[model samples]
Structures are given as C-alpha cells and as structure tokens.
Target: MNGFAATLASQLTSALPATAPLIKAALRADPGLLNNCVSLTRQLERLVYEPFQAIMKGDLLKETISKGPFDIVIDGLDECEDKQGVEEFIDHLLDFFQEHPRIPLRIFIASQVEQHICERLEDDRVQLCNLDSHSPYDDIKKFLQVSFCTAAKRDRVIRAYIQEHGEWPMKPDMDMLTEQTGGSFLLASTIFKYTIQPATAEDPTTPMDRLPFALRMNGR
Candidate 1:
C-alpha cells in the first residue's frame, strides 16, 4: 500500500532528489497506482532503479552519488502490516538479482525471528548471518578503552590521576577486563558502567578500585 511505496519513494528521493519531479508526475498520472505491493516494486524498478542504473552506465555517476556501493538497512520487517507483501517483496528482490548478483548494493534486514520471515529468507540465494556467530572480544575491549577515556575527560579527578599515572588501563588491567567479559558485549558494557558509576560516601569505589576486582570475578 502507501507504506511500501512511500518508504521506497523516500529512499529513492534521498538517493536522487532530481527525480522527485518525475516521481510526482508518475503519481499524478495514476492516483494510488502503487497501492499494491507488486505494483510498487515494479514501478520503483521503472521509475527509480532502471533510470539510476542507466545513468550510472555513462559519466553521470560522478554528478550523482558516490560511485562506491552502500547497504540499505531495512529494519522491523516483523512490523509490516501485510505479511504476504513481505514475502512477495523478498521474492521479487532476490529474483531481480538472479542473473547479475554483483550489483553495487546490499540490503540488510533486521527483524525479530518470526516463522513467516524465517521461512521466506531460508534459501540458497540468501546469505544469513547472526550476531551470535561473531566473536566480539576485540570490539568490546576497544569500546571499554574509549569509554574510559571519554569519562576521564569529563571528570577532573580521573584526568589528574591519568596525567600523574600513565594509561588508566595497563596491560594487566585490560587483560583482566577482557577475560571477565567472557565474550559477552552486554556483560562487558554493564561491568564498565558499574565500575565508572559515581562513588558515593556509602560505597566510595573508583573505576581503578573496581577494575582490579574483575580479576577475582567468578561464575560465567
């Protein structure tokens, strides 16, 4: 309906604002023409995709956007009103690239694991990847280090302490923090937050005091 058409049209306009008039002309010729999901996809291909690709073939690519490829992030697929529409859109998208799969574009769909959605994506053509498959130890360590640096800048005490001492997190401290994370980014963030929390009179513990205790932490 209007949802899919509007969404696609917005993206198209964002990518190529010069085509807004053409899009409006097409809509004016046929009112609510893209109300159907299939029509929306087809018209989008005609009005947006084909023309864009055609322009890209010539020297016009430089006048438009970056020649480099980019990913389209489509989130909340499970929230679509028309479940059937979702299936058809996916089918059409995959079929569109059946012959030429090297198009400089990607679609990243973020959706809750619903039966219908899962069934549609479960195909040889689609490459499915999950966050659980990736090891986030290095990323988590980098985030922790950056977060501490930011916090230290805001707090004078921390800045003074760091200036007097070297880096707040030495090799041993970083190692303990990384080990305590146990490969869970959420746990790592939570521990970092707890460590950096303002020290009260009742429980006056600085990040330095709390960070070392991570070495003694137990239970995964």
Candidate 2:
C-alpha cells in the first residue's frame, strides 16, 4: 500500500506512477544507486518495490501513516474468478508481511471456504477458524425478537391486534416460532417477513392472520 499495488508483478506497473517521483528524488540524491543495474527487472525493482518499501519504512519510522498496523480485509475470495491469481496473492501477501514483521499491517480475509484456499492458508502464521462452527440459536432468537418488536411499530393490523390481544404473539407463540427457526437466519427472516406483511384484498392475509399461522406453518 505504500506505493506498490496489492499484487506483486501485475500491480508493480500501476504503482510506478506514484512511486516514480520518490524514485527520481532518491536517484537524484544518489546517482550511483542503480547505475550498475544491467537487467530490466533490477531497474524496475529500483524504480518501484525498493522505493515503495523505503517509503513504508520512512512512514513507519515517522509514524505518519494513519491506520498504523491496519487491517486489510479481503471479503469473498471464493467468489473470485481467477483461482490461481488468488493463490498467488495469498502467497505473496503472507510472505511480504512475514518478511516485514515490524510493518504494521494486518490482513483479514473472509470467504466461503474453498479447499485450495484452506490448504494454502493452513500455516502456523495463519489462524484458520471455522466461523460456521458456532451455533446461532441465541443470535437467531434475538433477531426474531427485535424484528417482531420493530414490525409491531409499523403494521397497523399488528398494532391493533396487540392492543386488543395484549400481544400479537404470546410468550408460547414466540417460543414456538423461534424454536421453529432452528438456528437458521434465513428461516428466522422469512418468519418475520410473513409476520409483518400487509393483507391484500385478493389474499386477505393480514400480519395478525399470519403471526399465529407462522408457528404452525414454520413447524416447531
């Protein structure tokens, strides 16, 4: 991020524009730095990666970079079309940070678990956690509770029903519906959807008509 792009060689070219000035300034200050470099790759290394790393080091020393030791979030890696490119990115990224341990940058990747990705990331440096292992029962229950309370504020039919019946869904009904959701957020969401929907003249199924039925329909 100092100046080099996220990818190694592929991103090196785009970083040239930003790093060019810094490279020029350094070269002017000391002309003999890359004067002996015969290889194009070495010349490019001088122009981009070296300058970028130097800038990073300078910034780190000065504490000028905001979000020091910042997190780099890579969401939806599994959805990426270029599988090999993703692999290379993970490899180079981990190596770069590992090589520069003092550099304050934390990378966090969130993706649908893929075997190849899992295999590459299974290292002592990487703490691989299974996010889906935890039960979502409490979360789902809380979601339903909050959703029902919010829906009660909006729906006239539900409001009227609550006023007449004390609560649209009694404690037993709430428990039944929450239990029926079975820790599935999708099912919990649909239960709330059906519980708040307005009655149409054609269907004539008001939220009040749907709330009690959701427990029965969704099943315990």
State the local distance difference test value for candidate 2.
0.67
Instruction: Output the number of the lDDT-best candidate.
Output: 1
Candidate 2 lDDT over residue span 43-114, tens digit each: 444654466566565545456366455454667888877676567667766676678766655678898889
Can you list the residue pairs that collide in candidate 1?
Answer: none
**Each prediction's whole-model lDDT (CA):** 0.73, 0.67
lDDT of 1 by residue, 71-157 (tens): 668889898877777887787777766755766567789888888889988988888888676887889789888988898998777
Superposed model 1: Cα runs more than 4 Å off? 1-68, 74-82, 99-102, 110-115, 122-124, 153-155, 198-206, 213-219
Error of 2 at 86 (Å): 1.5
Q: What number of backbone clashes does candidate 1 have, counting pairs of residues 3 or more apart or in separate chains?
A: 0
TM-score, model 1 to reference: 0.62
